[model samples]
Target: MIEILSPARIERARDAGRLVGTILRTLARRTQVGTNLLEIDAWARRMIEDAGAQSCYVDYAPAFGRGPFGHWICTAVNDAVLHGKPHDLRLSSGDLLTLDLAVSLRGVAADAAISLIVGEARDAQDERMIATTEQALAAGIATAGPGARVGDLSHAIGTVLAGAGYPINLEFGGHGIGSSMHQDPHIANTGRPGRGYRLRPGMMLALEPWVMADTDQLVTDPDGWTLRSATGARAAHSEQTILITEDGAEILTLPNP
Candidate 1:
């Protein structure tokens, strides 16, 4: 559903967004070499419950997934890109990890994701991939505002990713988000400007830009959820939920200070 949030709903969205951002930041800080994926999920669950918030992922049964997600957070590692169900694997130094989270507060939901390298054994290419996705995310968010087209955000993001020589997977991208985990106005990573759905005040969108180091193809892991790069190349993903306003957009997922 394409929901133009009411003022009251928007306030609740901010609460959801703050919780989501705080949880992601806490996870990123607590994560390190030898940390198990399941541990991350556990931390997320604890935080969500303590805040009286709801996890949008746990018990999530979407047609694309095998069944109920049955996890509190997505712990994508290395080649794994999206819907990365947390498992029992322990992370190693230099491993690229992505944490995608969604939370609901008072019935409003917000989603965001971040990719980082574990420990200090970082590779130049890995750093570049993560940085590229972050840049693309910023570009996409910058292009969003009232009266703007979804294509404008997509084009802005695509330019940064393509310019950095990364292949983008289009099967999944950003979308309008409000009362639910996902909503309308599917925003592709690449598109022509001045096309697609036009932005309006009170609308919110989750703009994510993800890319792989090599091939554009994606393979589903045996877990029936984790999406990995076809070439086993390291990948990165960056995202933020923004509110379109009269002037421009606000990054609601900006970490809680």
Candidate 2:
């Protein structure tokens, strides 16, 4: 489904995006050494309920994942990259953690993710990987706007990641988002420019750029959800929901400064 939200609907989406952004920021602030992954999921659940918002993940039953995610947020650690199901594991200092979240408010949904080093920084490579993903996300956003091609955004993102010497994983990337969490117009992390869907006003896209440190291969964890690097190398992911407008792209899920 490729949804072009109306102005009013876009406004509602902005609200949903704000909620998602706030929750991610709150989690990042509250997370530290000894914090359990399950604890993070619980915190997300409470916040979503308190805000009268619906979690896009908790009851999610996608073909790619086990039925009913049963978690409020995805807590991907170190080698783990996408679809990370929060478990009983406790966070340790310098653990590269990625928190991916989505929520619906007023019938509109927004999704975003962030990767960071928890507690003290021990690995410089981890810091670089996180920074690279962030930079790639920014590049993707910068290349998005009305009349632009999805491939342009992908190219921008890929350039940043490849230039940084990280291997790109195509198993998952960005996508159109609106009333539901994931939608059509699958945006790859890397693509040839001048190809793919053309951007239009009122469209919302979740542009995520993730990479594995050493190899491009991924191994599914025993949990049947979390995706980790095959080589056991660390990984990083960054994302933001943006609205394509007449002028350019306006990022809807930026954390509060």
Clashing pairs in 1: none
RMSD to true structure for each model, in Å: 0.8, 0.8
- List candidate 2 stretches off by more than 4 Å: none
Compared with the true structure, what per-residue lDDT tens digits does model 1 show for residues 1-257?
Answer: 78998999989888889889989999999999999999999999999999999999988998889999999899899999999999889999999999999998899889999999999857899998999999999999989999999999999999999999887778899999998989999999988999998999999999999998997899999889999999899889998999998899989997789
lDDT at position 62, candidate 2: 88
> Given candidate 2, what's the lDDT at residue 216?
91
Residue 31, model 1: Cα distance from true site in angstroms: 0.6
| lDDT leader | 2
Q: Per-prediction TM-score, please?
A: 0.98, 0.98
Local accuracy by lDDT, each model: 0.92, 0.93
The residue-by-residue lDDT of candidate 2 on 122-237, one tens digit each, is 87988988899999998999899999999999999999999999878787999999989999999999999999999999999999999999999999887789999999999999
